[model samples]
Target: MSRLPLAALVAAFFVGLAWFVSARQALLLLVGVGLGSVLASTRFSFTTGWRRLILSRDPRSVIAQLTLLAAAAAISMPLLARFPTELNAALGPPSISLLVGAFVFGLTMQIADGCGSGTLYKAGLGVPLNMTILPLFALGSFIGSAQMDWWLALGNVNPIGLVQLYGPIEAFGITCLGLIVLALAALIWSGKKTPWFDRRLLIGAIALAVLMGLNLIIAGQPWGIVYGFGLWAAKIATASGFFNPSHNWFWSQPDNSQILSQFVLLDVTSITNIGVLAGALLVSAGKPPARAPRLTPTQWAAGLVAGFVMGYSSRLAFGCNVGAVFSGISTGSLHGWIWVPMAFCGTLIGVRLRRYLNFSG
Candidate 1:
């Protein structure tokens, strides 16, 4: 069948399922597909964006991310204020665990060459390394979630969300102002000659912001990745009788218990995550062929290790690029801001490590 026909069939399936299941989930799937399509089409990558800026003075990708952050904040704040019942912020406490996790996640993304979303979308696009990393990442998320209570006990303050603390107006102003300053600093540092923006990148950034905001509106929660990945692994482990949820701190919660008992598709994040993979595959099918990476076995091993660490650390730290950085900052959570700088520092170290490993791109 032609791509259009295939697309229609897929849409019909999801739509019918929506009728049988819930309208909100269908919307979440559509949003995920939209996010994946944009991510694939533009190759917008938080991992490379940060790495490039740190190592090569390339700010184009980083600028796209900042644009994304600004748009998400703008769209998110009003919705959060007006519809507090239906929406949730991506908030996490600022603590030693968060600082440590974000830094490790940052370094891992640089070494593994993909963030949470990046790994998922790229794996869907048939990138070998990402395909390998994705599974490891999931497993790590599962392990991390299982151990999160212990991590939290190390030292954690209550989460500080600007929306909850100061209301939408102040939150938006603070976030946008900070973003503008960061953007200007990036531009100045990248030098005067490099192109300030790419049309596709800018469009992707805005589209992503809109979609993520829609995710909050529809899912009754902000966008998240690690939680779903952990759920996936948890379900499998439970099914195999290798793990029990009855006593685990994270899994034993009432809400989580309910989710674990249901079909994965009924879960908002899993459905959305699947949609991202599907949408990426669809887009890749239509796009020109991509050159495969040239990587040695040692490099692959390094990436796998890094991927595992990325997932585990993300869970410990409360989220990855999408959860902690994108959703967190967009929702005016202090953890989001905290994650960025620490991850950047980790990226600095990762870049240096990459050279030593002879994994230069």
Candidate 2:
């Protein structure tokens, strides 16, 4: 089938998956696949293609991140107010070790061309090295999760009543969200140095935001791209003998594919990742190979090593820049804030080193 038609089929699949996940109710599989395909195709075209929005420097990405973070924070205010218990965990706020881990994560992500979700997403674009990183992410994540209990002990903070940054620190949450939205709008309107305003980008952003928001509401867990993908791979490698199941990696349990889209099923948003890469290919299929984004020899080595480090940190931190930082911050989690800045600062330094290192496309 053509990518267009296949995409339509996938969109339906995701809608069905979301529905099924939400209600534990089954809808026609064909319907799921079809609607999912359309939605995925739309997002891939608009978000990944038209925007030409690279993660590190794209205005849209930053805007979207800030917007989502603010929204999540705003929504959390009332929720915390209503159900005081849901406000914040008693776990220690970013410990010295977490700060250290975050710094390492920042450096590593810079070395690797992309963060956790970035790896899988780029893999869909058919990068050869990303294929390897996917598995490594799984292995590392398993180790991280297994040792998470120990880290939690180090995370010693009595999470205060919903972070009210203003008049009442609790009020700070929603107020910040509004200010963020305003700021992003201003930035988007300011200039056209790079391609940011596009229908495709808008579509993808809306779709992603909606999916993320809804997931938070029902699952009490955020919508994570990289960790989920890594976990998906973990399931596959475990079955394929790539990993030793006897090690007791915790989440390496049975594939409750009925709930969230498991790795093997090629379900909804997972297919969206597939759709994103495919959509990019379809657009540039006849064009030259993206001019092979130039990189220095050191940058190249950094990319490879950074790739592994990012994978490992995704495991230790329980998510990637997108999943842990973006999604986490959007949901008003403090850890999210910590991770994003650290990773971004790493990017600035990484860019400076790009010409010196063996950076690759």
What lDDT does the true structure give each of the candidates?
Answer: 0.88, 0.49
* lDDT tens per residue, model 2, 84-116: 454331122555445655666666655555565
The candidate that wins on TM-score is 1
lDDT digits (tens) for residues 339-361 of candidate 1: 98998888889988887888766
RMSD of each: 1.5, 6.8
Model 2 scores a TM of 0.63
Candidate 2 — which residues are off by over 4 angstroms? 8-61, 72-93, 129-132, 149-155, 158-207, 218-220, 233-301, 358-361
Clashing pairs in 1: none
The clash count of every prediction, one per candidate, is: 0, 42
List where candidate 1 sits over 4 angstroms from the true fold. Answer: 5-9, 286-289
